[model samples]
Target: MAEICCQEAKSPPATVATASASAAAAAAAVASSVMDRRRRRLEMKRFRLATDLEESAAEYARAGKRQRLQRTASGSPPCPGAAAPAEAETVDPDRCPRYGVSSVCGRRREMEDAVSVRPDFLTGSSSSRSHFFGVFDGHGCSHVATTCQDLMHEAVAEEHEKAAAAAGSGDEEIPWKEVMERSFARLDERAASWATSRSSEEPACRCEQKMPSRCDHVGSTAVVAVVSPTHLVVGNAGDSRAVLSRAGAPVALSVDHKPDRPDELERIQAAGGRVIYWDGARVLGVLAMSRAIGDGYLKPFVTAEPEVTVTERSDADECLILASDGLWDVVTNEMACDVVRACFRSNGPPEPASGEGTSSSGKAVSRAESDKACSDAAMLLAKLALARRSADNVSVVVVDLRRGL
Candidate 1:
């Protein structure tokens, strides 16, 4: 009887162990199955996201191609939202044709920043077009900047034409560097004449009427960009800047001419001028920038010579941004480019084809949308400067350089 009891108890223990092992194995298998399912779900999510991105990019490309074909076939006018090319100049559809500008006084008592946009400013024999964009920031008064807005493009066009004619053939590349330098020199001379003869010239602004002497000290920073199908030429004379967004990267087209720059400092010192740090580095504790148009009182130290950079256009070129110190002081080049890129991406579809199933207001609707995108980009940058507490006048120009797509 004792032996039988012991055997029975051992049998029960064996059975219990077997059941425990089976349960553990089953639990582990269940857990492994759940993990496998989760992994598959994650992979599926990744695949879907990748597919969506690819589809979106392909759609964008297709849309661009279709729109180009429509425009070519219809021979329609440019989007009404864009600045009209010069009446005498022929518009090249392949060139950069869209741009936006925004300017504001921005926490300052006087508005001194000026922006100029002239599309198709120059036309070559091969029918290539060059668009001109400029941003001028005046220190003592607005007249110098206003003058730049009114006259810089004309001077650039004149100089460019002379250079082209001298080349004898449009097939030959024009020397953009020399052309820009001559144009800037001429502009500076004119500005100097304006300042000296302020009394003879009719009063155009508050400075001339109430503060006539201020005209003598007045100076303006000039940052000009000439965009052609093959090249981009930038001329900078002061603290204002020009930046190109190529492949989503910010490429500074012109370096700011600040008094504290090493080379600028050396040049000023060589000219027997001192750089004083009052508020910021200043030429003789007066002008914040080392070079500018006008400021004849500062003479040899504050030159009108511009630093010109000519960059060959590339497939990756996205857009060009020109802005005064008010925007640069508060916004970084990368940040500005990002904002503009977003604006471009968010732009709606192109205008409907005229002959196809298009409505009467289809072109108008599309034009407004396209125009709003660029203008919004410029306005957004200026507003951001204000939000960041920039103390100077704000001006921004966003030029769309995306070609063919």
Candidate 2:
């Protein structure tokens, strides 16, 4: 009987084995489907980003073409004028003219800081000898900061040419100081227009909706330096600053347009803006500094005119540092100079040396490396501020003139 049973069992396949094989195949199919779905999702994300980038480039092209047409019709050089649209709202790599500009964002928010550096032209022509550098620190949002970064240099270059023509001076004879002043005004106007256009556009993402009027209130602090073969002209609005390091010491070129300053306070009051003092020494009630771009809501109480200063670069002038408040908050001007001096001592590269500085081998950190350091530093500072319970978005930019010069 046992032998008969064994024969029966062997004669047909067991139901359990068949069921297990089918289940295993089903699980594998499901996993494959899931992996395919994930890949498709990632592809869609990349496609959307690419589309947005393309659209931004198209917008810039259209804007540039329009400016060229207007210039031709007016028979004027393409200085930024009333006809030029506001600066572009997005950051595009094609727009970057300089070689090294390190940027980093904070942990709690998107990066709103922008920087650019153009080496002095060496064509042996009059205009080729001038070097230009600038920093824009955005508050409320990044649109204004990014726009200024892209357009400020071009605007300055155009204005310099226009000023030369107005004075019947050749490019070589153009007055750098006058060019800086006029260019700054033009930058403000263009930035304002850009902000307006951005505000008028319909919201496409949650970020836009949350900050519906970001463009309107999203003003930026600008500090620009024009380094010529003979002198340096600096223009400042808001707190972003440009400092000169002469013989390894610090010399401030731009004034901080804080509401607490007597001049700034008076200007704000004259413009119908009140400065709210907190705890006797702190300023809390004012919306912004005495000067800024955008902040249309505070336009009635603030001015867009920038304060300009020009100085001859003496033999003592070794380096210049242009930075946003982020670096200033954590490091003083003296300290910054010392840091750079230390880096020089270590035979580091010409850029500002921080913990991010390079080794003694002389190979400076990569752009990505510096960028990550900056981002990490800003985030760490923000966290520290939070630990101390401070509320404000942090942004920073550092420009080292020794290397570029």
Candidate 3:
């Protein structure tokens, strides 16, 4: 895309400027419309993906598994008649119960954002009913983000299993906060190793285009939320964020790590990395985040130590939202919460799954609107960001805590 700005360039006193206020406004409006269309296209594509995931969820229901989001009012008790969620429901340990949507928007031809939703994410009899959701935003390339999407959860699971084993059998609790910290540290080393191994196989060049240093400079920001019946834990490294809806209000679950922040700035300077102001405060004017995975070249300066927080689940905790910076760059926490609450509330009651009946072995199944609250909220948030002209790829994940996914 060509650079087209509404602001008129300074003209010499001798020349009458052709650019007018009305014309600039018209151009700006056109730009916004075009970006909106791009967002719509990406959203349409994500809807198709959501449709597939919906089918996957239906399969679980067909297999004697009911994954429904029980609607409970803010700070209210469970439905007066419905049976309350068991303190320890013996889940299949393989049922994944969450869904999300992702979109590419505005000026970027290729997207570098990746997201994941894993339920029953941990293995063995000890680890049960835990789900993980995340969004990864990449700079320089999508490889790092894609790689993290594929491997980070596995690392977390491995760490989780270790913690579970150490705690011993029979209803012992695991400290997920410590697990998140250790798992993130392990992923940093693993991502670095992945970049190194791939470079060793490729032919070397010094053009900075085909050279190994290209990937060495690429990195991705990660924000993850771990949800279970009793606990909600969030871990973040970079600008991606997680937010929870508490009684229809938005509460930030993770903090954005930026080079401009005092603590982040201090860390960079201590590591002999300059935080130069170039469009914005960047570590050596190259990276915007102070901590992230990958970016082998920026190691020591850009650590992958995630800030982890753990909280007990409460009735006020309605749902959770996770997204990349593209969404946050345009959407405020309050606006996002309001939009989601409205979208979800719009759906009244779930109808029976409608479609031609098919065996559980079949690949496809039908879905209803009532069960699609999270997916709908996620798609709308991405569109909202794009409509606001966020100039980056957008990704969103919405997990229904009431559903225990």
Candidate 4:
């Protein structure tokens, strides 16, 4: 260090010595301050590291506690509820038809998608633990979708109840596919009635969804799957679809109803409506879908009658997927099945089984990990669709068929 301060001195040596000592002292002080600041910054970083570790541990503990405590009545699963979860939904592997659902708002400004799962959709003497899973994609408004999410199951249950009552004498059998179609028809009529009943001048919903009575045809597309002990019945309207993952392959269960389809176009024309080419094919250049719920303005042209398909469950079936068009617009059935199968595999190498005598090539998925697999698969599909630039909201449901999830 070179000294800058020098006091009046008789000799040059003494003056030089004083200046050297003063400069050294100043340099030492500056160095000490710099060292102190660096030390404090390092300490702060360590403190933050500790804080973050503590928070993470606490969250993990809380999650474990919630899993242990959260339960529903016997034979039923719990809802994700108000926590909004922000995480994948899980169910105890002990439950039947191990299924989980997930929905995401993609490039759209708002999330207009709805999903639901009813473990014990119907309960009684027949004792069929039929499960219900559905995805509703809203267009122009989310109200109708939300409404269907809340009421569609009840309509189905009503029909099932009637069938069960009639079969009490053991003379009749409950036909699920027919019930599904009837339920869809009832759902459409219910929505139409509910919409027309609303005040003509009522205010729009929080999402700015128009009242069904006054809108340009606000409606929702629906795809539903009913998991009975013997059958997997699917019903769909609009473009939402359902696919069954079988032996690691994709088997489409419901066909997407598009305006461009021959039958759909013919129906529209028969109803005295035009199928015009606008932003692709559309009915009267208005609704892009040929069938939907609560499109009162386009009624007689756009119907809510869903096409139902029934497939008997077999050991070969792996899982089921019900998703909105937002997913189908970019993702394919094979791709979705592959993603879900991968998720199940990543969960823990599938449920371990002993002995090589069995010919089941694919490992069985455990009920405990099944929920995570389904939820993850759904979320992954939605994210994949978004990454592929899907322009609408996305929703997905995965039901583990083997070992009853």
- The TM-score leader among the candidates is 1
Q: After superposition, how far is residue 32 of candidate 1 from its true place, in Å?
A: 65
Per-residue lDDT of candidate 1, residues 281-304 (tens digit): 999998899889988889899999
Candidate 1, residue 125: Cα displacement in angstroms equals 4.0
TM-score of each: 0.72, 0.59, 0.70, 0.70
Q: Between candidates 1 and 3, which one is better according to lDDT?
A: 1
Model 4 TM-score? 0.70
- TM-score-wise, the better of 1 and 4 is 1
For model 4, name the residue pairs that clash.
Answer: 93-367, 98-404, 98-405
lDDT of 4 by residue, 187-301 (tens): 7777676656554655667423434345545689988887877777788898999999999889999888889999999999998999999899998898889999878789899
| Superposition error at 356 for model 3 (Å) | 16
In angstroms, give how far residue 139 of model 3 lies from its true place: 1.0
- Model 3 steric clash pairs: none
In candidate 2, the residue pairs with backbone N, CA or C atoms under 3 Å apart (3 or more residues apart, or in different chains) clash, namely 86-194, 121-128
Q: Which residue runs of candidate 4 sit more than 4 Å off their true CA positions? A: 1-94, 167-172, 204-216, 349-367
Candidate 2 lDDT, 1-405, residue by residue in tens: 999999888856767778889999999999999999999998887667556543543453465455445434644453343233222222121121122233445344666777767665223324336767888887767777777888788877787766666777444456766766676677767767765666768864343577766456667888888776556688888887777778878999988888889977776667666777663322235354667766776776666677888787565665566777665655567755544344333322223223233322223433454333333333333333233322334443333343321
Per-model RMSD to reference: 16.1, 19.1, 13.2, 15.1
Each candidate: what lDDT?
0.80, 0.60, 0.71, 0.74
| Number of the top-ranking candidate, with lDDT as the measure | 1
